[model samples]
Target: MLTLFHSPGACSMGIVFLLEELGVDYTLAAIDLRKGEQNDTAFRQMNPKGKVPTLILDDGTALTEFPAIAYWLCRRHGAAELWPDTIDGQARVLELVEFLVASIHMRGFTFLAMPQKFSADPAAQDSLRALGRREVEAGLATVAAQHGAALCARSRIGIEDAALFYILVWARALGIAVPAPLSAYAEALLARPSAQVALRGLAAG
Candidate 1:
């Protein structure tokens, strides 16, 4: 069986949602980031980067990074609905995934949540967090303006939606204001059965 290494409330939750949506059987391994479990030797052996959402395949190979894992699952499990069918559609999904992960999650939330990593001075840490907040807001605004309408019209959950939902959770935690339409979009995603199952799975893990 496949095993997914994840941290509660992390971007790995997005991968959990994808796995649940695909109806795949997988085991969950919770990594406690708060206690510095990610820095442990055992975890580092699995993923040198020491990141969550690491997938250990049945063949004993490890796969890290959310987008790559999502794509691998979709292709291996024949879940084409999770992604687009056409070239342009596929490109758009990839684009959104990259933006959400890199620009929003990495540049914004990661910085905001762990500003001390960026600087040694106390005042500098606060400044870094403030900058992260602005980046998050700008990134969210871009998402809302570009994809809010399309997301509202989606009848089935897609990979991009899973990624976006994770970001929305971070946005809420950071007290970033979401536009009304995107907030509704997020609500719709949360209401999905797959999403519900993912939440329960995360809680259990």
Candidate 2:
């Protein structure tokens, strides 16, 4: 009885993977970002920020933002192991997820994808993209130090892996070179059955 407002090929796929991991039934509502449907009145009523991965719970408590939604889902479905057992482990996962989402994706990739959002001048946009590359590469080095790719396991894919997965997707699309360990880790996660099904559902939607 949950509903997810998502955009295909967007970071919302991370939430889709979480839903698949939880093995929970939920509605997938497609919002075409190219068409600017997210800014439409109906969706704005749900989430004024007009972002994807908007989750409407059964009781109609709409949730927005990746970290918050992912955390709530993992906690609500504790058996998934998306959440760690100990407080330190949980804190570690939260820290990694926060960095990947807040710093890497929002600050880094967003600039790479839409540099003009930061500035109108072409030269400034190019400079902004260069800065974005530095931010992303630096973040990847931090992730590599943590063995982030290994966060995905045969039994369960931790929320950190899901968070890392989206940024890796953007990196590849933008032609940024991913370090060997994280690249291999992402390929393995893609081979996961849950990821396969989640991707298929998003593509179909």
Candidate 3:
């Protein structure tokens, strides 16, 4: 069985949702990031980066990063619809996933977690946040344009879509504004049974 060290509503929830979607049995170890549990030495040993959503493999090793973790889980469970069987297909999914990670996720972390690094002056900080908003809006627009097309249904919730969903959820939790198309796509995805279960599980915990 796999063990997931996750913080509720964090990017780790994406993996939880995927596990639920795949019907894979696993253990959930909640790490309360708000209380600094993630910084504990034991947790740091699991993920040197001190991040939530560290996945412990059956062999007792750990896996980090959204795209890589999702890829491994999908392949391990033989869930082709959520991963893809062919090399080209997997490559395309990974390509889009990387785009989300490099562009959207990075910007989110910078704005939300490291606001001080962007600017010292209050006005400058506000300016940076506004810029971050525009960046997030543009990124989500791109995601909607790229993933909301009819072609997306052919692939289902593959790696790109999964990562895209994770970013959208994270942004919303932080009160970041989102455009209609992206919001709609996220809402539709969240309406799925697996997603609801993952969310409710987090709420319950």
Candidate 4:
């Protein structure tokens, strides 16, 4: 069986949602980020980057990173809908996922939540946070314009939806305002049984 290493309320929850949606039996290993468990030797042996959402395959090979893990699971399970078969459709999903990782999580949330990582000076940290706020707002707008309406209209949830839902969790925690459409879309996703199951996993952790 596969084992997924995750932290509560982290972006790793996206993988949990995907696993629930796929109906795959897997073990959940909760890493307590608050206590710095992710930085420990055991965890580092599995993922040198010391990040959550690390998947240990049945053969014991470890996989890290959201985009790669999501794609791997979708393909391994033959869930084509989650990751379209066609080049163009697959590209679109990847584009959205990468944008969320790069523009939103890396450039926006990381700076906003942990500005000290970027600079030591207090003034620079404040400026970085302000910039993160702007980037987050702009990123949400882009997501709203690109995928919000389509995601809400679709009956089946996809990989991109899982990723977007996770990002919204961070947005809410940071008190960042999302676009109106995305706000509604978030409600829709949360109502799904799969999303609820994933949330329960996080809460239980």
Best by lDDT: 4
Q: What's the distance in Å from true for residue 168, model 2?
A: 1.8
Candidate 1 weakest ten by summed lDDT: 196-205
lDDT per residue as tens, model 3, 1-205: 9998888777788888888877789999989877989899998988999986789998999998877888888888845466566889777777778878877777854575556776798888877777766777778777777766543455366555567667877676667765666666677777788777666545431
| Candidate 2 TM-score, true structure as reference | 0.90
Which residue runs does candidate 2 get wrong by more than 4 Å? 149-155, 200-205
The backbone clash count of each candidate, in order, is 0, 0, 0, 0
Per-residue CA lDDT of model 2 for 1-205, tens digit only, reads 9999988778998888888877878999999998999999999999999999999998897999999988888888647456678999888888889999999998888887889878999999999898889999988888876764454433566677667767776676677887767777777777777777556534331
What would the C-alpha RMSD of candidate 3 be, to one decimal place? 2.9
The lDDT values for all models are 0.84, 0.81, 0.74, 0.85
- Angstrom error of the Cα, residue 139, model 2: value is 0.8
lDDT score, candidate 1: 0.84
lDDT of 1 by residue, 106-175 (tens): 9988888999888899999888898888888898888889999888987777778668878887787667
Q: Write the per-residue lDDT of candidate 4 for residues 94-161, one digit (tens) a residue.
A: 99999998789989988888899879999999999999999999999999988888877887767776
TM-score of candidate 3 versus the correct structure, residues matched by position: 0.84
